[model samples]
Target: MSTYMAFVYGILYLLFTTFTFVFEDAYGFTQSNVGLVYIGIGVGMLLGLAVLGSASDKIAIGMAKSHNNGVIKPEYRLPALVPGGFFVPVGLFLYGWAAEKHVQWAVPLLGTLLVGIGIIVSFMCVQTYLVDAFTVHAASAIAANTVLRSVFGAVLPLAGLKMYSKLGLGWGNSLLGFLALAMCVVPFFFVRYGERIRTNPRFQVKL
Candidate 1:
């Protein structure tokens, strides 16, 4: 689940990094204007982290309380992904097609904002889930997740130009949105079967 979350994060970064060019070419945004637009993403991410990060803990505790004995399962963290899963693709679709159609600049910017919120929400949930699931070996789990997503982030941008050129922003981002949509299944799977999966002997680690 963490790996899949990282992969989506990679795609989100790819879309974000390339948006400068997209804004300039498609909407004729000046460099300063583009920078201002980017501030929206930063602000969105900050708010998302603040809200969702704390919410995850509250949710886990609530779930634990519901269990009578107050034992929290890592799977409880996954419900946070629900809002993110729905919004990420919606934001991507809006960003891509709005840009492609040259809709009002605010339209795409709103999409960017949603994308920012969605990505951070998903990221926070995944990180929390991994830490809760691998209490003793969380460092290794996070390191692996970081490495995989970093590779995707580094490499995927190289194709951004060609992808947008051939497919146009609409289809290119739609492709990404579709991928993100598919990744939503990861959390659902974990929510349903995570405890059983964690019971495997291979997952056990000494502190």
Candidate 2:
């Protein structure tokens, strides 16, 4: 779950920084105003972390307790992830097509809203699942995931500008959006069978 969340957010960090200007130009906003548009997503992300991040832990705990079979089903943590997974690509498509046609500013902004909310929800889901799954080694799991995701995050951003420029906003982001859509299935699969995966004796031991 944490791994899935990391990859999703890794894509988001790439999209937000890369695509904001693309939308802004569509709306005919100045560079500074475009910066502000991304600020909205920034503000949204901060608010989401504050409110939903810890709530996911509480929700997970309740679901885990309800299992009553002495085993905490990891799938319980996946519900919140569903919304995030759906919204990320939806937002990307909306933002991409809107910018391509130069639609109303709000159209692209709506896409940003979906993206911001999705990222936060997914981030919380991933973090909480990791904490519960590897209680004793949660920090280490997070550290490792963070390192790899960061490399992708860094490399993707560098390439994003060139991609958007060459393909144009619609195709470039749509291509990325499709990739996100494919990755969205990962959490669902994990949720359905994560218990079985974790049951392996190898996973029982902490790294």
Candidate 3:
């Protein structure tokens, strides 16, 4: 899951690294205005965090109640990934193509909003799931996740210029969108197999 988040975040940051130049070159915005253009994304991120924060707890608690043991597995925190996975890819495509086509600047801004929403939703889910799954070692799990996320976050953006330069924003981001589409399967995989993996002796042996 951390691996999944790493790539998703890296892909999102591609826009983070590139959008300022996009606004200037495509939308004819000055430096000061570029910051203002990001407000849509900021709002979208907050909205996602707010909605998912409440929704995730509700879902986990509801599922826990349904369990005969009255215990919630970490996987219960993952259903939100279903929607989150969808949002990232769709948002990427929307923003990428809108910017590439030079449609109304607002169109791309709307796309950025979706991207922000997807990113925050996914981020929260991953963090919560890790914390639950590794209760005694939650800090270690989170530290590992954070380290990998940071590595990818720092490294992937470095590729942004070459990627956008060669593939153009549309296809470059489409490549990321497709990668995100592939990652959508990860949550389901974890949900179905997580308990087994956690309990498996060989798995623990490997660890």
Candidate 1 segments exceeding 4 Å error: none
Estimate the lDDT of model 1. 0.83
Please say which candidate is ahead in lDDT: 1 or 2: 1
The estimated TM-scores of all candidates read: 0.93, 0.85, 0.95
Model 1, 108-165: lDDT tens digits are 8888888888878888888888898988788999999998888888888788888888
Query: How large is the C-alpha RMSD of every model relative to the true structure?
Result: 1.6, 2.7, 1.7
* Candidate number with greatest lDDT: 3
lDDT, candidate 3, 41-96, per-residue tens: 78889989899988998898888899836778898989898878778888889888
Model 1 earns a TM-score of: 0.93
| Clash pairs (backbone) in predicted model 1 | none
What C-alpha lDDT, on a 0 to 100 scale, does residue 165 get in candidate 1? 88
Q: Rank the candidates by lDDT, best first.
A: 3, 1, 2
Model 2 poorest ten-residue lDDT run: 18-27
**Top model by TM-score, which number?**
3
